[model samples]
Target: MREEVNMPLNLEEKKELVKEVSDVLLNADTILTADYRGLTANQLTEFRKIARTPGIYIKIVKNNMLKMALKDSEYAVISDKISGPQILATASDNPGEFAKLVKKFIDNNENIELKSLAYKGKELDLSEIKKLATLPTYEEAISMLMSIMQAPVQKLMATMTAVPTKMVRTLDAVKGTKN
Candidate 1:
């Protein structure tokens, strides 16, 4: 087996990386950082495949570079969780859905541990992230709202039809008894 040489990223490459991370951060609705130290390449690839939703981006960048990218941004609070072998995952829409995806991956992978998550510039602990994961997606929420809104109308219509049908039944019974 050939030993792989670890090459340091040059100044231009580092700058470009920081820029790319910054751009992602600017549009992100939620940012999740995890300690991916014990995860193998295959496990990481599996996670990437599971996280293939649109507007989601995941990367393992140098801590310093990530810090530089996060500097002066709303996500600056996440720099505290940037130490060690951290994998950053961000999504532009539906933070709860992103949290659910990360939670599912963590549940399946014993080696990976959740570090912290930042949403709307606020830092949240693992428990809070779990709560976030339980939240419904946008489509689910809309469907739920529609059902709730229709319930009263449906009940009213049923009640109105029931009164007329009951009167018709009573009239038929009275006419039969008279005959």
Candidate 2:
């Protein structure tokens, strides 16, 4: 026969678990909360597949559990937004990328409802979050800036190369005039 069910953990153990989870959440780079009430199992699976790329982590948890873990934690900034069957996505790289993916998914699937988002413990408003979703990621922005910086230098080199031919033509004209 199966062994008897073990008794629940004492308060100290529970506190430790909460502290550990809170620390993990606090250290996270980005956190996105959403209502997954209407999403089907298949859709959630697809969502997970999409999230798995780029070191994104998705989890569904009880609001109370989240609240307990986040209380007095750095992640408490988003505590108010966690309630009623909420799901979270944590991104380790390019926080904006995951937000963009979520926004795209929401646009495609009307079932997902975005509730709130946080970047580095600062909660983002709806419009701000949308703007973040639309923005190019940190790496992409850096690359764009590098390309822009290189453009002017490339143009200057092209203009400088023309100077030699112009000087030659001017010298030839002077010699012809002297003759």
Tens-digit lDDT track of model 1 for 1-179: 12555877779889999999999999988988888988999999988875589878999888899999999679898787778988889989998788888888888999998877888878877778789888899999999999999999999999999999999999999999999
**What's the residue-level lDDT of 83 in candidate 1?**
87
Model 1 stretches with alpha carbons more than 4 Å out: 1-7
> What tens-digit string does per-residue lDDT give for candidate 2 at 28-95?
78777889998999999888887667667777756777788767766687888887898777777776
lDDT of 2: 0.78
Candidate 1: how large is its RMSD? 3.1
